[model samples]
Target: MKQQILFSFSLFLLTFSSFYYPINTASTAPASSPKLAPAPKSPSPASSKPLVPTLPDTSDSTTPDDITKILKKAKTFAILTRLLKTTEIVDNLNSQLITAKSGGLTIFAPDDSAFSNLKPGFLNSLNENKKIELLQFHILPQFVDSNNFDSLSNPVETVAGKDPLKLPFNVESLGNSVNISTGVVNATVTGVVYQDNKLAIYRLDKVLLPLDFFPSKVHASAPVAAKAPKADDHKDKSSSAEDNEDGETTQGQKKSGAVSFITIEGTRTMLVSLGVAFVAVAMI
Candidate 1:
């Protein structure tokens, strides 16, 4: 009975030893496996501000060097200062003239005397709206000199307004003169005396009528046919008609001698009157 119990115990020990040995061997092996790290996130899109455009400085660099130099000169400023004293508008005009780009332009600069000669309250009456037109009249956009005046026809269009001012170019053997055709009633004349680079100055006798002066036609005159007849023409036609009528009366009286003197005179007078009427009608 003791031997059988000992044999059972030996068998159980052998089974336990086999299982324990395998488990211990697995735990003792080297740790060569890679570590599990968190997945890397995609980088956020780059945040950047939009660029802005800048404008060039026109006031400082764009102005021509020559124009800048001219404005700085003492003599030029002195002349301009004197012009400004007369009226406020002249000062504004001076500024524009000096700064203007060099282009062929004829400027009819009015003097203090010219403004003084203007009709009462004329300068004061000019409103802001009309000022541009008045200024335009004095400026010819194209550069024109004294020499160019001869080619321009009377009533040349000005910047002043749509109604072109009649500028009649009168050329004589000596030289040329510029006359403003105001129409049959009044005519104003100006003479171009000074010329500078892209600028011409004219001395005017009177202030030109503002473009708004006449509603019918601004500075336009009647056609030649509408003009009044000359004095000499009137006299010649009257004398010629009287002479023809007298001659007809004398001839008729001689041919009708048999008629009574009174009757003859009456008949001759009527015929003479008819002939004179025909002559007068034809003359017209």
Candidate 2:
């Protein structure tokens, strides 16, 4: 009886050990290996460079208010304003001029008097795709006072075309002039007079056009060829010519000629003759 009791106890111990072993093993499993750490963040890409703003080519320093007020009061300017309002290009150009930070732009604004000479369909045609070009023709790349207009050189390039035109002109303060190469026309302002620092207003006899703005069927024209000598070239040529002229006459020769040309009585007849000969030689 003792042996059987001992065997039964042994069997009970074994069954309990089998059931508890699995539970203990699961509890000690190290918490699912601490789940892997998350990946580190990557750095951001670099930014692109910014673009620079370009300045508009102009020289007139008049304020937008001045332009607006003048245009509003003048009959010809009012017509142009109306035309500009209807055209996208012209409207944008006006807006640019108003908002431009750079001062000093010379604008050759046409007035109602200018439109008087246009054919019925001419204004309408300009209102079409050529509005930008028409607006550009009136703008000079530099600032020029009314007094400097007479000194302007030919072939002044305008924003109207890829190439420049030869502006044929003979401007006088009292005379009408047309720089066909530069596509500029100056007309007498007749009754209009400028006051204070304001520009002189004018009623144009005709509307200005770009050299290439017209269609071939209407009036095909070519850009003015560049002809004015470069500054360096002109300087070099002038210096060379002067050097040649100076080298031809030595100090000894000049002194001899002076002695021969002067009379003891102090008459300058020989000197005058020599001067005339020198001038004649220079002309040749």
lDDT of 1 by residue, 1-284 (tens): 89999999999998888877655755698978998899999999752322111112212333232322332331223322343344354555456666777665565555446666667886577666565555566566666655555555545666654443443222121133344543322323344334466555555555555534554554344344566888988789888887788878877877676467778789999999999999999999
Per residue, candidate 2 scores C-alpha lDDT tens digits across 1-284 of 99999999999998888877755766777785567888988878642322112112222344444444555654346777676566544455446555666544555566676777667787666545677667666555445444445555555544554454232222333233333333344443233212213233333445666545444512334545689878999889999998887877676688878887665435676678889999999999
Candidate 2: worst-modelled 10 consecutive residues by lDDT = 50-59
Per-residue error for 110 in candidate 1, Å, reads 2.1
Query: How many Å off is the CA of 23 in candidate 2?
Result: 99
Candidate 1 residue pairs in backbone clash: 104-142, 104-143, 105-143, 136-160, 137-160, 155-166, 155-167
Runs off by more than 4 Å, candidate 1 = 1-103, 164-174, 184-194, 216-284
> Could you tell me how far off, in angstroms, the CA of residue 1 lies in candidate 1 after the best superposition?
99
